[model samples]
Target: MKNLLKNGLMLLTGILMLATSCNQISDSESGGNGKIVLSLTDAPFPVSLVDKALVTIDKIEIRSTATVSSTTEVTTNSELFTVLYDGDPMEFDLLDLQNGITTELLSMDIAAGSYDLIRMHVTNASVLLKDGSNFDLKVPSGFASGLKIKMTPNLVIESGVESEVILDFDVSKSFVVQGNMKAKNGIKGFIFKPVLRATCQKYSGSVGGKVFENATTPIAEAHVQIIAADTILSSALTDAAGNYHMIGLPTGSYKVVCEKDGYTPVTVDPVVVKAREKTTLDIQMATATVTVNP
Candidate 1:
Protein backbone atom coordinates (compact mmCIF):
# COMPACT_ATOMS: atom_id res chain seq x y z
CA MET A 1 0.00 0.00 0.00
CA LYS A 2 1.29 3.56 -0.95
CA ASN A 3 0.75 6.87 0.83
CA LEU A 4 -0.26 9.98 -1.09
CA LEU A 5 1.70 13.16 -0.30
CA LYS A 6 1.42 16.83 -1.21
CA ASN A 7 4.43 19.01 -1.75
CA GLY A 8 5.58 22.34 -0.21
CA LEU A 9 4.59 23.68 3.23
CA MET A 10 1.20 22.00 3.02
CA LEU A 11 0.07 19.54 5.67
CA LEU A 12 1.32 15.95 5.38
CA THR A 13 -0.65 12.93 6.49
CA GLY A 14 -0.53 9.17 5.96
CA ILE A 15 -3.03 6.76 7.41
CA LEU A 16 -3.24 2.93 7.14
CA MET A 17 -6.35 1.04 8.26
CA LEU A 18 -6.41 -2.56 9.56
CA ALA A 19 -8.66 -5.47 8.48
CA THR A 20 -9.36 -8.58 10.67
CA SER A 21 -10.74 -11.98 9.65
CA CYS A 22 -11.31 -15.47 11.09
CA ASN A 23 -12.37 -18.95 10.04
CA GLN A 24 -15.62 -20.65 10.89
CA ILE A 25 -15.74 -22.38 14.26
CA SER A 26 -16.36 -26.12 14.33
CA ASP A 27 -18.95 -27.84 16.51
CA SER A 28 -16.52 -30.33 18.02
CA GLU A 29 -15.57 -28.04 20.93
CA SER A 30 -18.20 -25.47 21.84
CA GLY A 31 -16.66 -24.44 25.14
CA GLY A 32 -12.90 -24.68 24.72
CA ASN A 33 -9.91 -22.42 24.34
CA GLY A 34 -9.49 -20.26 21.24
CA LYS A 35 -6.39 -19.32 19.29
CA ILE A 36 -4.99 -16.04 17.95
CA VAL A 37 -2.22 -15.83 15.38
CA LEU A 38 -0.54 -12.47 14.87
CA SER A 39 1.18 -11.23 11.74
CA LEU A 40 2.57 -7.97 10.26
CA THR A 41 1.86 -6.42 6.86
CA ASP A 42 1.67 -2.95 5.25
CA ALA A 43 0.09 -1.15 2.34
CA PRO A 44 2.12 0.74 -0.26
CA PHE A 45 3.29 4.32 0.31
CA PRO A 46 4.37 6.85 -2.24
CA VAL A 47 8.05 7.02 -3.28
CA SER A 48 9.21 10.59 -3.82
CA LEU A 49 12.94 10.46 -3.15
CA VAL A 50 13.51 8.29 -0.07
CA ASP A 51 14.82 4.84 -0.86
CA LYS A 52 14.34 2.73 2.28
CA ALA A 53 12.40 2.86 5.57
CA LEU A 54 13.18 0.36 8.35
CA VAL A 55 12.06 -0.17 11.93
CA THR A 56 13.12 -2.51 14.76
CA ILE A 57 10.49 -4.07 16.97
CA ASP A 58 11.74 -5.60 20.20
CA LYS A 59 8.42 -6.58 21.83
CA ILE A 60 4.65 -6.81 21.41
CA GLU A 61 1.90 -6.61 24.05
CA ILE A 62 -1.80 -7.61 23.91
CA ARG A 63 -4.61 -7.41 26.43
CA SER A 64 -7.88 -9.30 26.92
CA THR A 65 -10.92 -8.11 28.82
CA ALA A 66 -13.75 -10.39 29.97
CA THR A 67 -17.06 -9.41 31.44
CA VAL A 68 -18.83 -11.59 33.98
CA SER A 69 -22.25 -11.26 35.54
CA SER A 70 -24.00 -13.16 38.30
CA THR A 71 -27.10 -12.77 40.47
CA THR A 72 -25.16 -10.69 42.97
CA GLU A 73 -23.31 -8.24 40.73
CA VAL A 74 -21.33 -7.72 37.53
CA THR A 75 -17.58 -7.71 37.14
CA THR A 76 -15.00 -7.24 34.41
CA ASN A 77 -11.48 -8.61 34.36
CA SER A 78 -8.64 -7.81 31.99
CA GLU A 79 -5.56 -9.89 31.32
CA LEU A 80 -2.46 -7.81 30.81
CA PHE A 81 -0.19 -8.39 27.86
CA THR A 82 2.75 -10.74 28.47
CA VAL A 83 6.06 -11.15 26.70
CA LEU A 84 5.04 -13.18 23.68
CA TYR A 85 8.43 -12.89 21.94
CA ASP A 86 11.62 -12.30 23.92
CA GLY A 87 14.27 -12.49 21.27
CA ASP A 88 16.23 -9.55 19.88
CA PRO A 89 14.37 -6.88 17.99
CA MET A 90 14.10 -7.51 14.26
CA GLU A 91 14.39 -4.80 11.62
CA PHE A 92 11.93 -4.61 8.71
CA ASP A 93 11.87 -2.43 5.62
CA LEU A 94 8.17 -1.67 5.13
CA LEU A 95 8.60 -0.53 1.54
CA ASP A 96 9.07 -4.14 0.41
CA LEU A 97 5.74 -5.22 1.94
CA GLN A 98 3.71 -4.19 -1.05
CA ASN A 99 1.79 -6.71 -3.25
CA GLY A 100 0.04 -8.24 -0.22
CA ILE A 101 3.08 -9.93 1.31
CA THR A 102 3.20 -10.58 5.07
CA THR A 103 5.66 -11.59 7.83
CA GLU A 104 4.69 -13.72 10.84
CA LEU A 105 4.82 -12.02 14.25
CA LEU A 106 3.39 -14.32 16.92
CA SER A 107 0.76 -16.95 17.78
CA MET A 108 -0.86 -17.81 21.08
CA ASP A 109 -3.91 -19.43 22.73
CA ILE A 110 -5.87 -17.55 25.34
CA ALA A 111 -9.23 -17.58 27.15
CA ALA A 112 -12.39 -16.51 25.40
CA GLY A 113 -12.60 -12.75 25.74
CA SER A 114 -11.93 -9.44 24.04
CA TYR A 115 -8.47 -8.26 23.01
CA ASP A 116 -8.60 -4.51 23.34
CA LEU A 117 -5.14 -2.95 22.90
CA ILE A 118 -1.82 -3.72 21.22
CA ARG A 119 1.59 -2.11 21.71
CA MET A 120 4.83 -2.56 19.78
CA HIS A 121 8.07 -1.46 21.39
CA VAL A 122 11.02 -0.40 19.30
CA THR A 123 14.67 0.14 20.25
CA ASN A 124 15.91 1.94 17.13
CA ALA A 125 14.86 3.13 13.66
CA SER A 126 16.75 4.16 10.53
CA VAL A 127 16.22 5.06 6.89
CA LEU A 128 18.32 4.82 3.74
CA LEU A 129 18.22 8.06 1.82
CA LYS A 130 18.50 8.21 -1.95
CA ASP A 131 22.02 9.64 -1.65
CA GLY A 132 23.55 6.24 -0.84
CA SER A 133 23.74 7.16 2.85
CA ASN A 134 22.01 5.61 5.86
CA PHE A 135 20.99 7.54 8.98
CA ASP A 136 19.41 6.64 12.30
CA LEU A 137 15.81 7.88 12.60
CA LYS A 138 14.63 9.23 15.92
CA VAL A 139 11.55 8.00 17.80
CA PRO A 140 10.74 11.26 19.64
CA SER A 141 9.90 9.84 23.10
CA GLY A 142 8.67 6.60 21.57
CA PHE A 143 11.33 4.77 23.54
CA ALA A 144 9.33 5.13 26.74
CA SER A 145 5.84 4.94 25.28
CA GLY A 146 6.66 2.91 22.18
CA LEU A 147 3.90 2.80 19.57
CA LYS A 148 0.38 2.21 20.83
CA ILE A 149 -2.70 1.28 18.82
CA LYS A 150 -6.05 1.11 20.51
CA MET A 151 -8.86 -1.25 19.52
CA THR A 152 -11.76 0.74 20.87
CA PRO A 153 -14.45 -1.98 20.24
CA ASN A 154 -12.05 -4.82 20.95
CA LEU A 155 -11.73 -8.25 19.21
CA VAL A 156 -13.60 -11.19 20.67
CA ILE A 157 -12.21 -14.73 20.62
CA GLU A 158 -14.63 -17.63 21.06
CA SER A 159 -13.86 -21.01 22.56
CA GLY A 160 -12.71 -23.89 20.36
CA VAL A 161 -12.02 -21.60 17.43
CA GLU A 162 -9.11 -19.90 15.76
CA SER A 163 -8.60 -16.38 14.43
CA GLU A 164 -5.85 -14.89 12.30
CA VAL A 165 -4.98 -11.21 12.59
CA ILE A 166 -2.85 -8.96 10.40
CA LEU A 167 -1.48 -5.67 11.63
CA ASP A 168 -1.05 -3.32 8.67
CA PHE A 169 1.45 -0.75 9.91
CA ASP A 170 1.63 2.11 7.41
CA VAL A 171 5.34 2.82 7.59
CA SER A 172 5.22 5.46 4.90
CA LYS A 173 2.73 7.52 6.79
CA SER A 174 4.21 6.64 10.17
CA PHE A 175 7.35 8.58 9.34
CA VAL A 176 7.21 12.32 10.06
CA VAL A 177 9.90 14.52 8.57
CA GLN A 178 10.70 17.50 10.72
CA GLY A 179 13.04 20.51 10.13
CA ASN A 180 15.87 20.26 7.62
CA MET A 181 17.03 17.02 6.02
CA LYS A 182 20.60 17.71 7.20
CA ALA A 183 19.57 18.06 10.85
CA LYS A 184 19.83 14.44 11.95
CA ASN A 185 20.63 14.80 15.65
CA GLY A 186 18.73 18.08 15.89
CA ILE A 187 15.11 16.86 15.54
CA LYS A 188 15.31 16.46 11.75
CA GLY A 189 15.34 12.66 11.53
CA PHE A 190 12.13 10.91 10.69
CA ILE A 191 9.85 10.39 13.69
CA PHE A 192 8.27 6.98 14.14
CA LYS A 193 4.65 7.82 14.84
CA PRO A 194 2.98 4.59 13.79
CA VAL A 195 -0.64 4.40 12.65
CA LEU A 196 -2.01 0.88 12.72
CA ARG A 197 -4.64 -1.56 14.00
CA ALA A 198 -5.47 -5.30 13.99
CA THR A 199 -7.47 -6.99 11.27
CA CYS A 200 -8.27 -10.38 9.79
CA GLN A 201 -8.14 -11.35 6.12
CA LYS A 202 -10.80 -14.03 6.25
CA TYR A 203 -13.41 -11.29 6.63
CA SER A 204 -12.04 -8.88 4.05
CA GLY A 205 -11.82 -8.51 0.29
CA SER A 206 -9.78 -6.62 -2.32
CA VAL A 207 -10.38 -3.80 -4.80
CA GLY A 208 -8.63 -3.41 -8.13
CA GLY A 209 -8.68 -0.89 -10.97
CA LYS A 210 -6.70 0.96 -13.58
CA VAL A 211 -5.61 4.60 -13.62
CA PHE A 212 -5.20 6.22 -16.94
CA GLU A 213 -4.83 9.57 -18.63
CA ASN A 214 -7.44 8.73 -21.23
CA ALA A 215 -9.49 5.82 -22.48
CA THR A 216 -6.54 4.38 -24.37
CA THR A 217 -3.62 5.79 -22.41
CA PRO A 218 -2.94 4.20 -18.99
CA ILE A 219 -1.35 6.38 -16.31
CA ALA A 220 1.70 4.55 -15.06
CA GLU A 221 3.11 5.11 -11.54
CA ALA A 222 0.13 7.07 -10.31
CA HIS A 223 -0.92 6.70 -6.67
CA VAL A 224 -4.34 5.18 -6.02
CA GLN A 225 -5.90 5.51 -2.59
CA ILE A 226 -9.13 4.31 -0.95
CA ILE A 227 -10.79 6.44 1.70
CA ALA A 228 -13.70 5.68 4.03
CA ALA A 229 -15.10 8.20 6.50
CA ASP A 230 -12.22 10.53 5.64
CA THR A 231 -9.69 7.93 6.79
CA ILE A 232 -7.22 6.37 4.37
CA LEU A 233 -8.02 2.67 4.17
CA SER A 234 -5.56 1.42 1.57
CA SER A 235 -3.02 2.78 -0.89
CA ALA A 236 -1.27 1.47 -4.01
CA LEU A 237 0.97 2.50 -6.86
CA THR A 238 0.02 1.88 -10.45
CA ASP A 239 2.22 -0.63 -12.17
CA ALA A 240 3.86 -0.12 -15.50
CA ALA A 241 0.54 -1.00 -17.09
CA GLY A 242 -1.30 1.61 -15.03
CA ASN A 243 -3.00 -0.96 -12.82
CA TYR A 244 -3.50 -0.59 -9.03
CA HIS A 245 -5.04 -2.85 -6.41
CA MET A 246 -6.03 -2.56 -2.73
CA ILE A 247 -6.21 -5.79 -0.76
CA GLY A 248 -7.73 -6.89 2.57
CA LEU A 249 -10.45 -4.25 2.90
CA PRO A 250 -13.70 -5.00 4.72
CA THR A 251 -17.04 -4.85 2.94
CA GLY A 252 -18.05 -1.22 2.85
CA SER A 253 -18.38 1.94 0.78
CA TYR A 254 -15.30 3.98 -0.04
CA LYS A 255 -13.94 6.70 -2.29
CA VAL A 256 -11.19 5.86 -4.78
CA VAL A 257 -8.69 8.52 -5.78
CA CYS A 258 -6.06 8.50 -8.51
CA GLU A 259 -3.38 11.18 -8.30
CA LYS A 260 -0.23 11.93 -10.24
CA ASP A 261 1.96 14.97 -10.56
CA GLY A 262 1.09 17.40 -13.39
CA TYR A 263 -2.28 15.67 -13.79
CA THR A 264 -5.71 16.45 -12.43
CA PRO A 265 -6.62 14.10 -9.57
CA VAL A 266 -9.71 11.95 -9.94
CA THR A 267 -11.88 10.73 -7.08
CA VAL A 268 -14.75 8.23 -7.43
CA ASP A 269 -16.97 7.85 -4.42
CA PRO A 270 -19.16 4.95 -3.30
CA VAL A 271 -17.00 2.10 -4.51
CA VAL A 272 -17.99 -0.98 -2.54
CA VAL A 273 -16.06 -4.20 -1.86
CA LYS A 274 -17.77 -7.30 -0.51
CA ALA A 275 -16.37 -10.06 1.61
CA ARG A 276 -14.19 -12.55 -0.23
CA GLU A 277 -14.82 -10.70 -3.42
CA LYS A 278 -13.00 -8.25 -5.65
CA THR A 279 -14.40 -4.93 -6.87
CA THR A 280 -13.03 -2.85 -9.71
CA LEU A 281 -13.22 0.93 -10.14
CA ASP A 282 -11.36 2.73 -12.87
CA ILE A 283 -10.15 6.33 -12.96
CA GLN A 284 -9.16 8.75 -15.73
CA MET A 285 -7.17 11.93 -15.20
CA ALA A 286 -6.58 15.03 -17.32
CA THR A 287 -3.35 16.91 -17.71
CA ALA A 288 -2.99 20.12 -15.74
CA THR A 289 -0.53 22.94 -16.35
CA VAL A 290 0.70 24.91 -13.37
CA THR A 291 2.30 28.34 -13.73
CA VAL A 292 4.66 29.57 -11.01
CA ASN A 293 5.22 33.29 -10.82
CA PRO A 294 8.86 34.38 -11.19
Candidate 2:
Protein backbone atom coordinates (compact mmCIF):
# COMPACT_ATOMS: atom_id res chain seq x y z
CA MET A 1 0.00 0.00 0.00
CA LYS A 2 1.16 3.55 -0.66
CA ASN A 3 1.93 5.49 2.53
CA LEU A 4 1.93 9.17 1.75
CA LEU A 5 3.95 11.44 3.98
CA LYS A 6 3.56 15.10 4.85
CA ASN A 7 6.39 17.31 6.14
CA GLY A 8 8.68 14.26 6.62
CA LEU A 9 6.19 12.68 9.00
CA MET A 10 4.55 9.29 8.48
CA LEU A 11 0.81 9.90 8.62
CA LEU A 12 -0.58 6.88 6.87
CA THR A 13 -1.18 3.93 9.21
CA GLY A 14 -1.85 0.50 7.76
CA ILE A 15 -4.01 -2.30 9.09
CA LEU A 16 -3.26 -5.96 8.52
CA MET A 17 -6.88 -6.80 8.28
CA LEU A 18 -7.90 -10.39 7.58
CA ALA A 19 -9.36 -11.19 4.21
CA THR A 20 -12.78 -12.74 4.06
CA SER A 21 -11.43 -15.73 2.16
CA CYS A 22 -8.62 -18.16 2.90
CA ASN A 23 -6.49 -19.27 -0.04
CA GLN A 24 -5.19 -22.43 1.59
CA ILE A 25 -7.36 -25.51 1.74
CA SER A 26 -8.44 -26.32 5.27
CA ASP A 27 -7.55 -29.68 6.73
CA SER A 28 -10.45 -32.03 7.21
CA GLU A 29 -10.48 -32.50 10.94
CA SER A 30 -13.10 -33.73 13.35
CA GLY A 31 -13.47 -32.86 17.02
CA GLY A 32 -10.83 -31.80 19.58
CA ASN A 33 -8.47 -30.19 17.05
CA GLY A 34 -8.97 -26.60 15.93
CA LYS A 35 -7.62 -25.04 12.79
CA ILE A 36 -5.89 -21.67 12.89
CA VAL A 37 -4.95 -19.70 9.81
CA LEU A 38 -2.15 -17.18 10.08
CA SER A 39 -1.93 -14.35 7.60
CA LEU A 40 0.50 -11.45 6.96
CA THR A 41 -0.18 -7.96 5.64
CA ASP A 42 1.71 -4.70 5.57
CA ALA A 43 0.69 -1.16 6.31
CA PRO A 44 1.43 1.57 3.79
CA PHE A 45 4.94 2.71 2.82
CA PRO A 46 6.38 5.33 0.52
CA VAL A 47 5.84 3.83 -2.89
CA SER A 48 7.50 6.67 -4.77
CA LEU A 49 11.03 5.91 -3.58
CA VAL A 50 10.98 2.44 -2.10
CA ASP A 51 10.53 -0.25 -4.73
CA LYS A 52 10.26 -3.27 -2.50
CA ALA A 53 10.62 -4.01 1.21
CA LEU A 54 11.52 -7.64 1.81
CA VAL A 55 11.20 -9.54 5.08
CA THR A 56 12.43 -13.09 5.54
CA ILE A 57 10.75 -15.05 8.30
CA ASP A 58 12.23 -18.34 9.42
CA LYS A 59 9.17 -19.51 11.36
CA ILE A 60 6.17 -18.55 13.45
CA GLU A 61 5.57 -19.67 17.02
CA ILE A 62 2.53 -19.59 19.27
CA ARG A 63 2.11 -20.03 23.01
CA SER A 64 -1.00 -21.72 24.23
CA THR A 65 -2.35 -21.55 27.77
CA ALA A 66 -4.07 -24.92 27.64
CA THR A 67 -2.84 -27.13 30.44
CA VAL A 68 -3.02 -30.88 30.74
CA SER A 69 -5.71 -31.90 33.25
CA SER A 70 -5.37 -28.48 34.90
CA THR A 71 -2.53 -29.96 36.97
CA THR A 72 0.45 -29.67 34.62
CA GLU A 73 2.83 -26.87 35.44
CA VAL A 74 2.94 -24.18 32.78
CA THR A 75 6.34 -23.62 31.34
CA THR A 76 7.21 -19.95 30.92
CA ASN A 77 10.03 -20.11 28.38
CA SER A 78 10.54 -21.38 24.82
CA GLU A 79 9.16 -24.76 25.74
CA LEU A 80 5.68 -23.30 26.13
CA PHE A 81 5.53 -22.20 22.49
CA THR A 82 4.78 -24.44 19.55
CA VAL A 83 6.10 -23.97 16.05
CA LEU A 84 3.43 -22.71 13.68
CA TYR A 85 5.60 -22.49 10.58
CA ASP A 86 9.09 -24.01 10.27
CA GLY A 87 9.17 -25.82 6.95
CA ASP A 88 10.94 -23.30 4.72
CA PRO A 89 12.05 -19.75 5.21
CA MET A 90 9.32 -17.49 3.83
CA GLU A 91 10.18 -14.16 2.29
CA PHE A 92 7.50 -11.58 1.61
CA ASP A 93 7.49 -8.30 -0.27
CA LEU A 94 5.40 -6.18 2.04
CA LEU A 95 4.46 -3.82 -0.76
CA ASP A 96 2.59 -6.59 -2.48
CA LEU A 97 0.10 -6.80 0.36
CA GLN A 98 -1.57 -3.45 0.92
CA ASN A 99 -4.87 -1.58 0.88
CA GLY A 100 -7.09 -4.27 2.38
CA ILE A 101 -5.02 -7.06 0.86
CA THR A 102 -3.54 -10.02 2.79
CA THR A 103 -1.85 -13.34 2.14
CA GLU A 104 -2.50 -16.55 4.06
CA LEU A 105 0.87 -17.83 5.19
CA LEU A 106 0.04 -20.92 7.21
CA SER A 107 -2.91 -23.11 8.07
CA MET A 108 -2.50 -25.64 10.82
CA ASP A 109 -4.57 -27.76 13.16
CA ILE A 110 -3.73 -27.68 16.83
CA ALA A 111 -5.20 -28.57 20.18
CA ALA A 112 -8.14 -26.37 21.11
CA GLY A 113 -7.15 -23.79 23.71
CA SER A 114 -6.35 -20.18 24.48
CA TYR A 115 -3.24 -18.67 22.95
CA ASP A 116 -1.71 -15.49 24.36
CA LEU A 117 1.56 -14.97 22.57
CA ILE A 118 2.78 -15.13 18.96
CA ARG A 119 6.35 -14.78 17.75
CA MET A 120 7.93 -14.44 14.34
CA HIS A 121 11.57 -15.37 13.73
CA VAL A 122 13.07 -12.98 11.23
CA THR A 123 16.11 -14.24 9.37
CA ASN A 124 16.75 -11.23 7.13
CA ALA A 125 15.31 -7.97 5.87
CA SER A 126 16.18 -5.43 3.20
CA VAL A 127 14.89 -2.41 1.33
CA LEU A 128 15.18 -1.73 -2.39
CA LEU A 129 14.71 1.70 -3.84
CA LYS A 130 13.22 2.55 -7.18
CA ASP A 131 16.70 3.62 -8.31
CA GLY A 132 17.84 -0.04 -7.95
CA SER A 133 20.05 0.72 -4.93
CA ASN A 134 19.31 -1.65 -2.06
CA PHE A 135 20.31 -1.70 1.59
CA ASP A 136 20.16 -4.45 4.18
CA LEU A 137 18.03 -3.57 7.19
CA LYS A 138 19.23 -4.37 10.69
CA VAL A 139 16.94 -6.69 12.61
CA PRO A 140 17.68 -6.07 16.29
CA SER A 141 17.58 -9.30 18.32
CA GLY A 142 14.99 -10.70 15.91
CA PHE A 143 17.18 -13.51 14.68
CA ALA A 144 17.84 -15.28 17.96
CA SER A 145 14.79 -14.77 20.17
CA GLY A 146 12.26 -13.65 17.55
CA LEU A 147 9.77 -10.75 17.79
CA LYS A 148 7.34 -11.58 20.54
CA ILE A 149 3.80 -10.09 20.44
CA LYS A 150 1.42 -10.71 23.27
CA MET A 151 -2.30 -10.64 22.57
CA THR A 152 -4.21 -8.26 24.82
CA PRO A 153 -7.06 -10.73 25.24
CA ASN A 154 -5.91 -14.27 24.53
CA LEU A 155 -7.09 -15.91 21.30
CA VAL A 156 -9.32 -18.93 21.76
CA ILE A 157 -9.61 -21.79 19.27
CA GLU A 158 -12.68 -23.90 19.60
CA SER A 159 -12.96 -27.61 18.93
CA GLY A 160 -13.65 -28.53 15.30
CA VAL A 161 -13.87 -24.86 14.38
CA GLU A 162 -11.68 -22.73 12.14
CA SER A 163 -10.21 -19.43 13.28
CA GLU A 164 -7.95 -16.77 11.82
CA VAL A 165 -5.44 -14.26 13.12
CA ILE A 166 -4.48 -11.26 11.04
CA LEU A 167 -1.10 -9.72 11.74
CA ASP A 168 -0.90 -6.10 10.60
CA PHE A 169 2.76 -5.28 10.25
CA ASP A 170 2.85 -1.49 10.17
CA VAL A 171 5.75 -0.83 7.87
CA SER A 172 5.45 2.93 8.25
CA LYS A 173 6.19 2.70 11.96
CA SER A 174 8.47 -0.33 11.78
CA PHE A 175 11.03 0.89 9.25
CA VAL A 176 12.72 4.02 10.49
CA VAL A 177 14.38 5.86 7.65
CA GLN A 178 17.60 7.65 8.39
CA GLY A 179 18.66 10.99 6.93
CA ASN A 180 16.55 13.21 4.68
CA MET A 181 14.59 11.29 2.10
CA LYS A 182 14.27 14.37 -0.11
CA ALA A 183 17.98 15.32 -0.19
CA LYS A 184 20.83 13.80 -2.20
CA ASN A 185 22.13 10.60 -0.53
CA GLY A 186 19.44 11.33 2.02
CA ILE A 187 18.45 7.79 2.81
CA LYS A 188 21.49 6.62 4.75
CA GLY A 189 19.79 3.40 5.81
CA PHE A 190 16.76 1.94 7.54
CA ILE A 191 16.37 0.30 10.94
CA PHE A 192 14.00 -2.64 11.06
CA LYS A 193 11.88 -2.71 14.20
CA PRO A 194 8.83 -4.70 13.27
CA VAL A 195 5.53 -3.63 14.87
CA LEU A 196 2.74 -6.17 14.62
CA ARG A 197 -0.88 -5.80 15.68
CA ALA A 198 -2.97 -8.94 15.97
CA THR A 199 -6.73 -9.17 15.49
CA CYS A 200 -8.95 -12.21 15.73
CA GLN A 201 -11.54 -12.73 13.01
CA LYS A 202 -14.18 -14.02 15.39
CA TYR A 203 -15.08 -10.62 16.85
CA SER A 204 -13.60 -8.22 14.29
CA GLY A 205 -15.47 -5.98 11.89
CA SER A 206 -14.54 -3.41 9.24
CA VAL A 207 -15.14 0.22 8.20
CA GLY A 208 -14.54 1.78 4.81
CA GLY A 209 -15.40 4.97 2.97
CA LYS A 210 -14.12 7.78 0.86
CA VAL A 211 -12.91 11.12 2.19
CA PHE A 212 -13.93 14.16 0.19
CA GLU A 213 -14.09 17.91 0.57
CA ASN A 214 -17.45 19.64 0.15
CA ALA A 215 -18.82 16.25 -0.92
CA THR A 216 -17.20 16.69 -4.33
CA THR A 217 -13.43 16.57 -4.48
CA PRO A 218 -11.74 13.42 -3.19
CA ILE A 219 -9.04 14.23 -0.67
CA ALA A 220 -5.98 11.99 -0.71
CA GLU A 221 -3.73 11.42 2.27
CA ALA A 222 -6.43 12.38 4.72
CA HIS A 223 -6.04 10.63 8.05
CA VAL A 224 -9.06 8.65 9.18
CA GLN A 225 -9.30 7.30 12.69
CA ILE A 226 -11.69 5.06 14.61
CA ILE A 227 -12.20 6.22 18.16
CA ALA A 228 -14.08 4.47 20.95
CA ALA A 229 -14.37 5.75 24.51
CA ASP A 230 -11.70 8.38 23.75
CA THR A 231 -9.19 5.72 22.75
CA ILE A 232 -7.88 5.54 19.21
CA LEU A 233 -8.63 2.02 18.08
CA SER A 234 -7.32 2.16 14.50
CA SER A 235 -6.23 4.77 11.97
CA ALA A 236 -5.34 4.93 8.28
CA LEU A 237 -4.93 7.47 5.53
CA THR A 238 -6.89 7.79 2.34
CA ASP A 239 -5.24 6.23 -0.67
CA ALA A 240 -4.58 8.00 -3.92
CA ALA A 241 -8.23 7.55 -4.81
CA GLY A 242 -9.28 9.18 -1.56
CA ASN A 243 -10.59 5.91 -0.15
CA TYR A 244 -9.80 4.56 3.32
CA HIS A 245 -10.53 1.18 4.82
CA MET A 246 -9.93 -0.33 8.26
CA ILE A 247 -10.74 -3.93 9.07
CA GLY A 248 -10.38 -6.41 11.93
CA LEU A 249 -11.90 -3.91 14.35
CA PRO A 250 -13.91 -5.15 17.34
CA THR A 251 -17.66 -4.78 16.99
CA GLY A 252 -18.86 -1.54 18.56
CA SER A 253 -19.93 2.02 17.96
CA TYR A 254 -17.06 4.29 17.01
CA LYS A 255 -16.56 7.93 16.18
CA VAL A 256 -14.94 8.25 12.78
CA VAL A 257 -12.64 11.21 12.46
CA CYS A 258 -11.31 12.45 9.11
CA GLU A 259 -8.67 15.11 9.07
CA LYS A 260 -5.97 16.65 6.90
CA ASP A 261 -3.68 19.61 7.24
CA GLY A 262 -5.61 21.99 4.98
CA TYR A 263 -9.07 20.70 5.74
CA THR A 264 -11.24 20.98 8.82
CA PRO A 265 -11.50 17.66 10.65
CA VAL A 266 -14.88 15.96 10.53
CA THR A 267 -16.20 13.46 13.03
CA VAL A 268 -19.15 11.14 12.49
CA ASP A 269 -20.62 9.74 15.67
CA PRO A 270 -22.09 6.34 16.37
CA VAL A 271 -20.63 4.77 13.28
CA VAL A 272 -21.69 1.28 14.23
CA VAL A 273 -19.51 -1.62 13.12
CA LYS A 274 -20.87 -5.15 13.12
CA ALA A 275 -18.84 -8.34 13.39
CA ARG A 276 -17.63 -9.71 10.06
CA GLU A 277 -19.34 -6.85 8.31
CA LYS A 278 -18.26 -3.59 6.75
CA THR A 279 -19.72 -0.21 7.60
CA THR A 280 -19.53 2.50 5.02
CA LEU A 281 -18.96 5.98 6.49
CA ASP A 282 -18.27 8.59 3.90
CA ILE A 283 -16.94 11.82 5.39
CA GLN A 284 -17.09 15.33 4.03
CA MET A 285 -14.39 17.59 5.43
CA ALA A 286 -14.59 21.36 5.01
CA THR A 287 -11.60 23.41 4.01
CA ALA A 288 -9.80 25.08 6.89
CA THR A 289 -9.20 28.22 4.84
CA VAL A 290 -12.33 29.58 3.25
CA THR A 291 -12.21 30.04 -0.47
CA VAL A 292 -12.89 33.66 -1.27
CA ASN A 293 -13.64 32.81 -4.89
CA PRO A 294 -12.14 36.08 -6.08
Best by lDDT: 2
lDDT of 2 by residue, 18-86 (tens): 222212222242237788876666566776688988888876778875432365433336677888777
Q: Write the per-residue lDDT of candidate 1 for residues 24-111, one digit (tens) a residue.
A: 3333423556776666666665454568777787766665433322441211122346445557767777766554556666667766
Q: Report the Cα RMSD per candidate.
A: 7.5, 7.5
Compared with the true structure, the alpha-carbon lDDT of candidate 1 equals 0.62
What residue pairs clash in candidate 2, if any at all?
none
Q: Each candidate's lDDT (Cα)?
A: 0.62, 0.69
> Which ten contiguous residues of candidate 1 have the minimum total lDDT?
5-14
Compare the candidates by TM-score and give the number of the best one: 2
The window of 10 residues in a row where model 2 has the poorest summed lDDT is: 5-14
| Model 2, backbone clash pairs (residues 3+ apart or across chains), number | 0
What's the TM-score of every candidate structure? 0.76, 0.78
